[model samples]
Target: MNPRGTRLLAGRSLLVLFMAATAVPFLSLFTTALAPQGSTPHGISWPSHPHWHNFVDAFNAADLLPLLYSSCLIVLGVVPICLALCAAAGYGLAVLGFPGARLVFGLLLLGLTVPIESLITPLYYQMQSLGLLNTRWALILPLIGLFMPFGVFWMRTFFQSLPKELLEAASVDGAGPWAAFRRVHLPLAAPAVSSLAILLFLWTWNQFILSIAMIDDPSKRTAAGALGAFQGHYGTNVVLLSAGALLIMLPTIAVFVVFQRHFVKALLQGAVKG
Candidate 1:
């Protein structure tokens, strides 16, 4: 084969291998989820009886409705506030160029380096002292703080890469700073903002450690976090566990499927800008 054709064949082989590796685990999980409720799943064996009702049973058994509601509540609380704050902060750093902006960016960069695990103990005590422990606010407040570094960084990069001619034209048109940001830039930033919101939602939804650590009430914990306790109580039921896992994953998968275009666009924009 010619060099180009050889390279194309190699790429195709790699893609197929990657897809198989990714798909196999989910396929195994799906098969296991379909197995009779009480049976143990042994590595990809086809179930003699596919128990489709296992999903319903798992949902009810896990009391997943409350957990799902809690996850939604947390995501709703976190995403908008984080986006608003980050957008303003990023615009300030990138476009406005306020004094000490570089210092603030440096601090945020430092925060990104700090692992979440290291803060859990201090956060637990801090929340308790504030009497926010066990409340959804506990999760919501910290998550916003925790997510700020990346959110601000992501938005700042985008804003920095924005064509200055647009801002200049807006200013020439008698637009003030807030007017330019609100009327001109914000609409243009829709894709980046939407992508950030989706990421924050996914992160907040999958927040396990903080939910399990900070919140005492199982009813208030996120679906992923509650899964740990659920597993503890029903460890023997592999089918139910698999079903619950899939159930918890469905919302995120659905969200990505719906907004994937925006997500891809934002990523492509970022790559090109970077």
Candidate 2:
């Protein structure tokens, strides 16, 4: 029983405790989803006769296919464009050091302080005036804008961490800024970009407020947003509601499970670099 061994044991115990805390809600949801329809199940008791078909019923009732399509469309529209814009802006600010770069970066930082909830009313009206309301564009366009502040900040921080010698060497080889960026930095930035893409995808996919506020049609809203309507319709049917909730959560969970390594790598990279 060395001191180090005691600390390791303590840390492992804490980790297991936190893991169980994280898993309890999902376990409860799963059990409730399997409960008999229209029956309010207490706690996390397993149903004697689990209604597996509730998932199918929830899917149909929620019309999840169109919602899924809309979410995918919005993600496609938002992630790539946001990544490009943020990366370029970050490069310009960190590497190029253009005039007023600090001022511009400061403004982006200020934007991060602004709450999304505060913009909802004005955004709704703006979308209505522009005739983008009730369409996927409403969600797509606003998300790109909303994500910019954090995206640019993340990219800028990563770019600043890169060795300046790399850029200098590229220049010595007669490479232009665009060439250096495309050939040298972009490849190095894959992990950061992949991590950012995962974050934007998760945010866009789970965007409930703007999806419901801007888009009137349930099918056009994000899967998480459409859940509000599903909840409204099946609020009394706790089983169906739970099933629908789990269905909506499936894609995000799957994505995180798949790309979690990249996400963790980027985070660790930042910590080490910082």
Local accuracy by lDDT, each model:
0.91, 0.91
Candidate 1 segments whose C-alpha is farther than 4 A from its true place: none
Give candidate 1's error at residue 116 in angstroms. 0.5
Q: List ranges where model 2 is wrong by over 4 Å.
A: 271-273
TM-score of 1: 0.96
Q: Supply candidate 2's per-residue lDDT for 205.
A: 92
Worst 10 residues of 2 by lDDT: 265-274
TM accuracy, model 2: 0.96
Model 2, span 1-274: residue lDDT tens: 9999999999999999999999999999999999888788999898898889999999998999988988888889999999999899988988999999999999999999999999999998999999999999998999999999999889888888899999999999999999999999888888889999999999999999889899889888899999999889889999899999999999999999999999999888881254
Clashing pairs in 1: none
Query: How many steric overlaps does candidate 1 have?
Result: 0
Compose the digit string of candidate 1's lDDT tens values, residues 1-274.
Answer: 9999999999999999999998899899999999987888888988877889999999999999989999989898999999999999988898888899999999999999999999999999999999999999999999999999999998898888888888899999999889999998788788899999989989999999999999989899899999999999888998999999999999998998899999999888772265
